[model samples]
Target: MSLVRLSIKGISYSQTQNGAYALILNEVDGERKLPIVIGAFEAQSIAIALEKEIRPPRPLTHDLFKTFADRFDIVVKQVIIHKLVDGVFYSSMICERDKIEEIIDARTSDAIALALRFDAPIFTYKNILDKAGIYLNMSSEDKSDSEESDDILSTPETFGNTSSDEEIKNTYAKYTLAELNDLMDQAVQDEDYEKAAKIRDEITKRES
Candidate 1:
């Protein structure tokens, strides 16, 4: 199978599942994006790693793993998202130490978070991308229209795994698009990404 390199796009809260997030991966040389649902802690860990400016007072679990690996001289070479079964992604980490290499199984979210810390490249089989990737239309002339299209295209796929947790209620339904935009900006300024994501979803819903 041919491998395609991928890069972090961003993370957003799942609209349909409580405490779940969608991790978006962009094909490095293509237009498609791979969205995988991940848990809250993993999402936050990956977010912090991506931001590079927010340092947690204590090392998060992934951070501890990186520290431990450094102490042992283990180096992460790359990450491979090797499989997709029932809406879940499976990944492997290529690590090397003392001129020997090892492959370690990892959750897609965890693998990605560690990849950011280690500056490791991420790759997935072309077949996997064909099966799960989504494309965004970027040729539109209107900027807002293009962004709206992107949000619509990047929605999370639950794949029958959503639990019984009641979805977050829509309190912004009454607000106009203009007001919602202001609220979204405020949410982002407050660093409430989950709230910002929900607002963005509401705006997208209205736009669509």
Candidate 2:
């Protein structure tokens, strides 16, 4: 399979949902962008990692996983967003143990959450990108055209008017540190790693 390297583009909250967000992944070499609908916690986790945020007193699950990996001397090389099916994106971690490589199935959100912890690259199959990608016309005159196209193609019901970078910063700005820390606790208590991740990110960004 042809691997399509990806990078974090931005994340936008689902305006219609209180606990959901859209995680946008962009192809490294092309304009293809895949927007995955992930839970707020997951969104926060990915965000925190991407933004290089600092954790509060308690370690989030992804953090614990990272700790465990370190304890075991395993290295996460990268994360592969391997597939998209039934409106869900699937991912895997490429890890090395004593020079041996292994692939493990993971929820896209968790995989990304962990990827951020490890400072690992994210990737996907070209076919998956082709299937779920969105393309924006960057021509100056096509602003409205791009907006319309994105609106039509967006997974989450509500689309933010802000550009990608601004949207992420805004989302991170929407919460207070204490509030995010509480949310992280709630997510962990509820066993929602995805939500926990998002909260972690928010805390990280605010601190940074």
Candidate 3:
């Protein structure tokens, strides 16, 4: 099977699952997005990794892994979402040390979190993308921020029901963009990444 490169699109709160989030991966050369449902802790870790400006007072689990790897010279070269079974995606970390490479099994969420810290590439087989990828009705890049946020927050049927954009909009409707931004920054500083993500979403929803 041919490999398809993917990039992190963004993460969204899962409307149907309590304490869950949707980790969206975009096909680098295509319009389809692969949405993987992840637990809240994994989501928080991944979100923290993406927020370059937010540094936790202490290392998260994934951060500890990176520190340990660096201490021994084990480097994460890349991550591959190599398999999917019953809606669960399987991944492997391509690690290198002492001129030798090893493939280590990992959960998709953990692998991705590590990928961000290592600045490693992520890829999945074409078959997996074809089977589970979601295609938004409209082009997200060309849409206005309001439109793009709506397009992104609409969960794929396989993932579960999505909250209406208006519902999410109303949750933070009273906050101005500046206020929302401040709230997000405070949430991050407090290590409340889930809250930070929600606030961030609202900020995106209103940004022009």
Candidate 4:
């Protein structure tokens, strides 16, 4: 199957599932976005990587992996979202050392997080895209095209959270958007992605 490159678009709380976030991946050369429900930790890790301005005082797991890889002269070449099965994505990390390459199994979220740290491209197979990808309508003339398309399109399948131990409470609705924004920022700073997801979900619910 041919490979289609993808880029990180944004992260938002998954409305269908509590304590999960949608990691939106835009087709590199198309309008479709692949939204995969990932855990809060991966969501925050990906968000921090994308922000480029927020740095944790200590290393995150992904950060430590990056530093360790660099010290050993092992470099990540790219990440591939190789398979989608029963609403789950399987990814692999392509790493190189001493001119030899290796493919390592990884969670799609972890692969993406490390890909960002290493400036690696992300890809998925065309067949997989054909099966699971969601197309969103857009137009340069309509600024509200996004909101309109969201309403017009069929909702893509959403995966559920693995556990309820960290489920986000709905208390966020009592807070204003501004308050949620502050809370989200603080959550990101404190690496509290469950709180961040809850705040984000409330903000998105109000916006929609």
User: Can you write out model 3's per-residue Cα lDDT over 42-82, one digit (the tens) per residue?
Assistant: 87888888888778999999999999999999999999999
Which parts of model 3 are misplaced by more than 4 Å? 139-208
| Model 4 lDDT, residue 85, Cα | 57
lDDT of 2 at 45: 70
Model 1 TM-score? 0.70
RMSD of 2: 15.3
TM-score of each: 0.70, 0.66, 0.70, 0.70
Query: Candidate 2, 91: how far from true, in Å?
Result: 1.3
Q: lDDT (CA) for every model shown?
A: 0.72, 0.66, 0.73, 0.71
Cα shift from native, residue 188, model 2 (Å): 33
Provide the RMSD of all predictions against the true structure, rounded to 1 decimal.
9.3, 15.3, 12.1, 11.4
Better structure of 1 and 2 per TM-score = 1
User: Which digits, one per residue and each the tens of the lDDT, describe model 2 over residues 123-176?
Assistant: 889877765555543556554454444321123211121134454557667777
lDDT of candidate 1 over 162-198, digit per residue (tens): 3322342347656788998888667544434445545
**Model 1 accuracy (lDDT, Cα):** 0.72
Give the per-residue Cα lDDT of candidate 3 at 108: 87
